[model samples]
Target: MSPKRPIKPGASNTSPDTPFNLPDVGPPALHRLPLNIAPQGEGRIPVDHLRTPVQSPPSHHAPLEIVDLPAETHITSVVVHAPIEHFFLAPNQLSRLPAPNALSGIRELGTQKHFVDLQEGGTVLLGIDSENHFRARLNSDSRPSGPRLERVEGTLTWRVKPSDESVGGSDSRLTLKRLRNPDDGPQEVVAPKRSSTSTGDGWSDPWKKWDSPPQQSSIDGIEVDGTRFLLLPRGTDPDHPIVYIKNPEHRVYDFDYMERILGTDLMQQPRGAIRVPPANQWEVDPNLPFQYPLKQYIATYFPLLSDTSLNKVARHQFGLANDGDMATDVGLTRLRQTFNDWKRGNSTPHPPLADPLLMLPTLATSISGSGLSRTLELPTLTPEGSLQRLDFDLTRQEWDYFKTTHSGADLKRLMASILNRQGYDVFTPTPSHYSPALVFRRKNHSFVFFISLHRVSKGRTIHQPLNSGPDAADARLNTQVGYPALQEMLQAHAENRLVWLKGGSQVHNSQSDSIFIVRDNDSRLGTLANL
Candidate 1:
């Protein structure tokens, strides 16, 4: 049977007709036996003279065997240092990086995108082999005018599985973990990359090649010659199978512009510097679609999903590293005192995917490390590509409100003004024909936002589309002639066009594009640019 489509308001599926099928009790004759009648009245037939025999319990010859749990399994681990920006922005998908050749001397299976749950910090790592546990630290020295570098530690027993389309082949997963932060020591700076040539040209913001390699390395290191991008000694990750190169690039260069170099801290996890496998060994590409194995896995094959599921896989909770389920104190704890901090909520432990509210604090912390807040401009995707935040003004929420207000030319101009602030060339066509369609053009992107205002109930604070009861048609429409004709007119330029039916209730529609609007809290879009 075909599944039902979305039901319109006031529609009913329950029918007034009686059901054709009914219970069967073999007519009035089987209703009751003679002496089997209820105590209230005697309808008298004795019915069966003999009763069925009861089944006896099993004898000693046929005893039941007790079931028991099998032997315990140990979790193996390995740490990955990832920068914070790439974890959150732009073509924000984790690359399907293959597993290390050998983790702590054990040959383990590898999966693609080992770091999808790397939401907050680089402190997490792969699970450990029961035989060998890996422990390492990146202890940085206290510099003048700098706060004590709180030792960033690794998370424990991370088991990450990828979706079918994940770069690491279908249904493959990785188990990883990082070292603990309990160790105390003076700044322990490991050796730098063998050559500064790694960062001489266009900077390798997130990942860089250190010793230029014998030019190649592989997951198995077998017949795969010229396998692409030899691994860099991912800084001071003690649990790293090999720390051939100390730092990917100069520590000073990492915060140059996060996402562009501005995302995570140089050393630790949970904002830890990620291991970027550049196309070659010497330099890393700071942009997406950079190279093989580490390129972004855009979800093109999947059908348009409801707004909620847009980020379901990339941001859903995998087995968290801090659930504290394991008995042994092998990860980030000493004295064997492990509690489910996430459940108790004593403190905010790292969640598999960082929510926007949680992201506020971390981003602010990263910004503090970045002296570039001097311009107060936010990093736009590429090199020096940034939003001029000093004078430009527009929180995405306000832009949405003004776009749907429908207040003649002033409303149109205000929408245009918001786009202009972000350096877009905004234009309002005559008649504002797209239910007041506004054209926004910037760089290579040209977008026509077909905005429709959502309706709200009289006393309720909630917003909605296509109001129900007594006033359904009273709700404003998408446009006078509606979307079909409008869509046909702009079909040639369909790629750049968009639907802005407000985020309130309109976002629930499966076809509406899901966008991340920076909330108004942080000095209001002046800090977090939507560009």
Candidate 2:
């Protein structure tokens, strides 16, 4: 094409011979583009643009911001049955309890490191006085070592008072107060105390009451104060005493405050309880399935295998022995029957079998040289190697001897062990004597067994000559006591009065009067009672 002249701004390069005269029109506002001058020897081309930079509409939602509040301390209390003098004045004894300094992840104060700075009628530790309303102190000893380290000091205050629950009023209540604050030390402030008359008639004597204080003492320390304090009572020995410990600074960080102060593990765990070993640490072989014999299962579930007597018996009974030689044959048969009954539609009337495993060697007939038969006699022997008749019944003397030696607890333990082997979760609740019920739970099924040993009456009628038979004796005993006992257990289970057996089926002795098992079934009672 021939060379064309450059068009000026706002001018159009159109021929005058065009069919129609058209007006010049600038770029639409929506498609407007900014102009910039090009440098010499540089050329720029104009491109049609439609999108323009527009600010996004302000968001209707606000940005989330989290603000942490300062940690606040609280006062907690526990009552223990122990002598107040032994708990507070005896430094060696108090050191054995759980203290804040002994907690993990916190600095450990050495043994005998804390001293009882006894204030008038109160105790002070780490600059916190017991007489004040303060409950905690930021422990300085636990503070990390650094220039920016926050010097946190944890202080504990304790008071000793008489306890009426103690035998002959010998036990005392040791009220403990824990405090935590950013201040350098505990502040002295007067806390209002409830008058003896205002509290209650039972609490009129401040020293006798476990909760109320006798009087308010003048506190001399910092000016800041806390609203709550943990009061712990010392009534009995450390083994069975009640103690409470909690972290008031739970909002900021989680920790056991009492464990740190007492320098002992105060977590309420079962006696002889063992932590489950890691999966890798277990002796289970990868090639074999995780299954064990009944005896081994019991030993694994309970920590009783450590006992020398029980360990030997368990090994002999179930380890390498065949099924027929197992000592728990009677218990196993009963358990199997119960399971089978449950599987079937049988609701009740499933009485356990008699002692089928108990057998004695009898004399056999011998043949003479010609064909004449001769009677052979062999000495009768008992399971314990005693020279007694196989069918010999327990005499009054023997029964008395056994009763004097064996305890109800032994029976409870035996029943629990048997139930545990059957895959039942067992729990022994506190104040067990009141209910004396053992709980067994599995899946959605739960039951309670109230075990009691009834003394056999010599005058009771025995239809079967088998004096050693548990069934005959149990039947006679049941007629006298078993039914009544069953009724009581049913009532307790129905009322939910028993703590451990609450909300579960009641099981009574299906066969033996000495042992009662309750299955968790509400409708089965009528059937059971009729049976």
Candidate 3:
């Protein structure tokens, strides 16, 4: 029980997982091209340079059939169709989209919020990327709205090349020798080949190979800048903490220079260093109970949130090289199971309430000084208006309509009423497109007020045959009127526009009566005393 020692300034304990902004050195260039397609023998063309053609191509005969076209006849071709995809936005999930900032690659188009285009081109991109949210319009043609979101049009190509170290290739370094425009942000710097030359403020080096095992600080190896040095903490090696530097920048702190400056033994340490495991460490057996304690187990095995080694380990041990695909449903399931096992928990929770703050009930204990509650308990609704779980399904259209129409104050009042009458309390957060429900109890009876929002569709329409049955026409008409009204009422009530569905008779006699239509200005609305 001693005070934790503070890391001395200039001391080397930098974790390997530190975010390294390495410069791009690979020859893969980002070029902006026109969306127009080129015919045989035509090279790629820039979009902005392209212009409308003066004349049309001859459709009668092929130029290939004849050796050459008549010199006297001027060949003219008009752009038949433009490659519209470049203009169209690419569809990607809202969650995957980076935060709206400089690094996100999405830039605002105008004054409108949530409307943006990709920086590469005029691709109209979605605001947020949660689940496959990118939709780009390649051309001027607009896509029809539907439940499934639309994406922008663009060809996103990614190539994964073998790392130079993995392939036994020399570390091909590219020194950003000189910058034509150093002050210009993100200006291209051309470094022809590998060598040590000073650039502006720091150095640039290519990312390391894929499979290169992290080296220990004490081990000897070839140096980047040909300088010699050794790792610190002297003979017995008692105090020097091993640090890992993945994706090191050679120009800023050239590996060799660091060794020379710090002293050959300790200065030239590996970018990533781990304490060499005990000479005869026990092998971990999956079947046997783990001997390593939980705290040590997590640090050594589970990798902390800030550990960069996790990236390398994931790539090697689990084939999880890419962060993008790690959160998939299958991956999430595996992660959940691992977390459960690590915590020694027997049960796993479901997707939890869509919006916990908004959906939970309000009680005297629920509210705080800041008007926030930590938990909400709701009664389970029955399927047949009996004792079942209360939930609702909604179509995209209905959801949109409700969000546009309602307010939070209206929703709170409605919840207050339901809780008093049916023994249920509701906690609605901010307005959203999701459907909300109420679950409450009465004397020896539990009821769930389930509200579902759906689009008007043929299948949902009640069938009414001509002269087939007397009640058929009335029933169909009644349903047609009641369903839409019901949707309208629910939305209004949810939004706080209306408080209660009132009728003179306790039980509704007419369709309108049975369904409490909103009376906006009824001064005689029930107080808590009535319930």
Instruction: Compute each candidate's TM-score over C-alphas.
Output: 0.23, 0.18, 0.18
Q: lDDT for each of the candidates?
A: 0.24, 0.25, 0.25
Worst 10 residues of 1 by lDDT: 24-33
lDDT of 3 by residue, 1-531 (tens): 101111111222233454321111111111112222333211222212111111233223211112333344322221122222222322222223334444443444454333333322223433322344443322222331111123233423211111122212333432322222334356343433433322211100111221123453334322322222222212122332332322222222332233232221121122323332333211111110111111222232222211222222222211121123222223222332333333332232321111111122222113234433221222222222211112222245533544454543333334435334322333332233322222222222112222212221212121111233444533432342234434443454455533322111112223111111111112122211122
By TM-score rank, best first, the candidates go: 1, 2, 3
Model 2 off-target regions past 4 Å?
A: 1-449, 452-484, 493-531
Tens digits of per-residue lDDT, candidate 2, 347-411, equal: 32322121100111222334344542232222222134421111212235533444554444444
Alpha-carbon shift of residue 285 in model 1 (angstroms): 8.2
Instruction: Give the winner by lDDT: 1 or 2.
Output: 2
Clashes of 1: 43
